[model samples]
Target chain A: MSGDPILSVDRLMMRFGGIVAVNELSFSAERRKITALIGPNGAGKTTVFNCITGFYRPSGGAIRLSHDDGRSIQLERLNDFRISKQAKVARTFQNIRLFPGMTALENLMVAQHNALMRASGLTVLGLLGLPSWREAEKRAIDLARAWLDRVGLLDRADDAAGNLPYGDQRRLEIARAMCTEPALLCLDEPAAGLNARESGGLNELLLSIRNEQGTSILLIEHDMSVVMEISDHVVVMDYGVKIAEGTPQAVRDDPKVIAAYLGADEEEAIAVMESGT
Target chain B: MSATSARPSHAAQPSGSAFIVKKALISALVALVLFSLMIGVRTEAGPQGGLIYWTRFGDLAALVGTVFGGSIIVELLRQWWGPVDKDSIVPKPVQSAISFAGRWLAPALLVFAVLVPVIFYDQRYILDLSILVLTYVMLGWGLNVVVGLAGLLDLGYVAFYAVGAYSYALLATNFGLSFWVCLPLAGILAAFWGVLLGFPVLRLRGDYLAIVTLAFGEIIRLVIINWQSLTGGPNGVSGIPRPTMFGIPLDNSDNGLAARLGIEFSPTHRLVFLFYLILAMALLTNWVTIRLRRLPIGRAWEALREDEVACRALGINTTTTKLTAFATGAMFGGFAGAFFATRQGFISPESFTFQESALVLAIVVLGGMGSQLGVALSALAMIGGFELFRGFDQYRMLVFGIAMVLLMIWRPRGLIGHRAPTVYLERNQSISSDLVKEGHG
Candidate 1:
């Protein structure tokens, strides 16, 4: 898990007619680490994630997920369900895609729908109003309750998910993904609406998940505190190019990383870094 | 992580006292229905005993329960749960719709149902019209699955109806099959046809699906018309058997039913029996459908109807779901068709036309796309009303057009349109708490 890459994406490209949203991006995110992809607006950060998650079929790239047989297969060729269920990649949305019409508990349970499919088995079990379906339904509810508790939302479990406060909705989105028990969790803008306290709690939640469940995290966050405090390794990009990658401290000082963040040319970037406010 | 700090407030939430009262009202209404139905049956049928007594009471209870229960639960939802759900299983667009339509449709439906019958007293014509309404109710329920639940508009649904009627006609004529046995066979054959129709339109959507299905119906009709050997062709098949009592025909011949039973008989008895038979079939249709609605697959169907993309993302196999709807719905349509063949004892290719599909679709939509009771009411109004209007001669279609326009303007979603129960409870869960219009809003 330390040196071996779990997800290796190479030379990924997504072209819409003439414009390239993601241009030849390449990176490897290893197991059980908080890897941050930081870039300015329109830097193709989210597009790259979409390609890996199989929401978009990349035009030219190899996204290989390491398997138990010590081989890798291209992820881009897989369907969305295959990426989610087979590749074990769970994701949240930029706009908080909780099923608004369902209760919070149901939203969480739907995330674990594939698990319930086993209870509805081949024998006369599911057809006869069998105890197995009942048991499975109960188990699903219990698991949802546990997740709600983890997210500090147990009291609001029965509430319609749309009614939740903005902060709780964010937390529930994360809890819903964890219900899938995926190998790689992709969070798109988790820290978008959070204040200092909520952001801190999010940081703590990610750190605990990484430590306890051995789950690798790939997060897109604009919050500097969240990105810098929790991220073990940061990949900085600008104008669809990977400018620098290393430990946070080293990348923070790099001329290219500084230029990218400041939206400046390299020469102007060095002048600002040299003046050193 | 959200900016909504401070402990979440429950200040705006309503209490549950009203829930109890609503339940009480429902129970009382059910009791009244039992009492009224029994009195009505005793006064009308001139005798009372067996399941009719129970049925009279049971129907009374069900009618009372559904209405009282529907009203109480809704009021409680508003008072206790908030008119616009902070979070509800209904989509936002659908919720806004239910709210907008509910404001006027309720009173208009009641007024029309009561006033129409009172103003028209032609009993002979009314009975004929009532049967028509019942037929459409059956058809609407069948089409609801394909169009409303599965979101598949089928312009060839009448093909399955034709199959049922033709199968019953052919089998009973050639081999002398009983109505009961032929009934199941008709359903099975129709389901087969449904699946066959389903395969061709798997990739089609909207108008494309509609056109292909229309072509399928036309193909079936042409085959019936052109098949010179098996089918009688355009002249159609006649002298088909009417429903009988143990090989005894209802005619007043030497060995007919009256002579065998040694009792004077009227043709109306058989008509009544046929009525009961179709009534039972319609009830069975309703029961099975209601049960299916409670299943996970049923919920998934509704979810799919709402959003196909989200349904797929949930890992539901859309293909299987669509096929099941087609098969199940087609089976019911066949059952109705078989009954039609047995009753009329003749069928023609002319019966399975594009207009038949339009009538059924109208029944489904006018009753509110997914409402069972609504469908039944719409059937009664459209078909029964149309039949009753026979005395008007040439004015029937005009009345229908006027009524339809008025109905649309009054309740655009159709009568008793698609409304799912707002509250779900365990078997032992009492309705005592649902008495008022206020609770955890």
Candidate 2:
């Protein structure tokens, strides 16, 4: 489905003091596909996500993001906000970092800040109540409303993001990331605390985003059901190194992936995996 | 275990009169310990230039007796009313009344402000006081951009004010520039300083940012004080030009506004003009801030406050956002400073002190941070309330401190604690202050 991968990491390395958090990890996520990074706790999946999103600078390696327009960006070279601004990479936190005090609609509106900022002539024309600025603001609100409708939170647009129910907040967060119009979306543990039904809903949302919006998603998830169901490609890690990577069926059958998840012997892991499936 | 539980129940059911008496005795003892030195002692200088001291045991006893009686009555009332609900200290009706007042208060205050100069045209003191109050309101509004909206705690806001005042003073005195020309120039210069201050403190937040800004303010004042060649050092720049109505001076001259209007030339006219001038400037600051709040940049500022990391994730350039906030706040401070220079006809480094910064910050905080109406009302209350307690002289600050403590206890988020959403869909709902975060920086 791709001429070239949307994102590729080459021999990435990250170190915190003497501890190597990630070591010589390499992976590529194809455009318009859902790529899931799965690992046990502290397997450095989030570190990889952080490096890709420019939250942390890797000690050694290259993170290259290719745009649809043939613009290739070295994500590691960019700073935190610039990664999102120029590289078209948007991410949500594991701990849900929505602007808690702001309304749900405002949360989405803030995501479109860069575009509206330019349309408002850096705020001067907007201050003067110019029609152009008003038009841009109206368009932004419309986009926000559309996202809210998609997330089934149109009625709750005016409610504070913090006050939303857990499932609603999770959906709202995804909607917020979408509002940025990012080419690549990174989500950290999107279904971490969701119930079975909520996670099922999340799978549908992620699929729709891929199918309808054509936005490539790179996610770090511990929930296997979410990882296997929606992920077109799966990368499994253990102790900061990629142990297995393939389609969901192949990775699920990988003995190393099961051993890493269960921390058991290869034979036992395979037996346990077979029984669980 | 049953016997122990029964004993506890027996203690809990102690007669009300006995329980009240026990509580009153404890309160009396505590009051005696607290006021023993403060109210029970008297000290004065002897005629021979030695210190003399006396004890007011009788007065102390009377105070202790009053406290004991007060405690007993309070205990009795508590028993009659049952346990107080911690959540609802003020009744529902009272809260609704306050909200109703808050909703209509802004327009009412504006109407009252407009009428002040007209009604008190002959009262020079009230006119001067009103001008002073308006000046603080403008300053509070200016600082609100940096501190309240952006969530940056700046302790050196007076630096911008000093910059503006000196800019106007040097320009008007040296180049003979009018107030109209210097006002904008001063604001620009102060904004430049704001950006200068902003750069070094970009990585800093909360108390550290506050400290650096506080130092920046002192540095500006110290530079002005020590730079004798340009600023005249402690002597200050005197003979600053006064403001005029367009080209017409508000003076007793042939080409003055009074003569042109064919009205009697009086000093009261000038005071009235100054009042109107400051009022207009304050309103302009309010108008611009409110409009800016609905803009992308304004929302970005709030988002930055709510969560800096989240802002960066959303691709907001926090450096520029913080710098713009600082520059905007400083520009208004500069405008107010320029007005101060013109109104006084003199400029001094002493005028822009840490105390001035503290006063303006106090006004902003007391006014509930971002609310424009709250800032204006707080300015009036602080300035006018200070004058109201002028007769107390020494006890003024003591009373003010107690009042401040009471206000903090009652409304920790300052007056008008609830935040009105800048832009909302459908019905606009006010957010409780408990949900709002005071920005880290």
Q: Report the C-alpha displacement of residue B199, candidate 1, in angstroms.
A: 4.1
Model 1 C-alpha lDDT per residue in residues B332-390, reported as the tens digit of each score: 99999988887777888888788998899888878876677778778877786776788
How big is the positional error of residue A56 in model 1, measured in Å on the Cα after superposition?
Answer: 3.0
Model 2 alpha-carbon miss at residue B326, Å: 0.5
| Model 1 lDDT tens row, A1-277 | 2486778878888888998888888888877888888888888888888888878889998898885457666788886666776777788778876655445666676666667656655212544568887788677778878888888988777665656889999999899888878788888889999999999999999998889888899888789899899988788766776777777788778876767666787678778557644
Top-DockQ structure, candidate number: 2
TM-score of model number 2: 0.92
DockQ of 1: 0.14
Candidate 2 chain B: 10-residue stretch with minimal lDDT: B82-91
DockQ of each: 0.14, 0.60
lDDT for B323 in candidate 2 is: 98
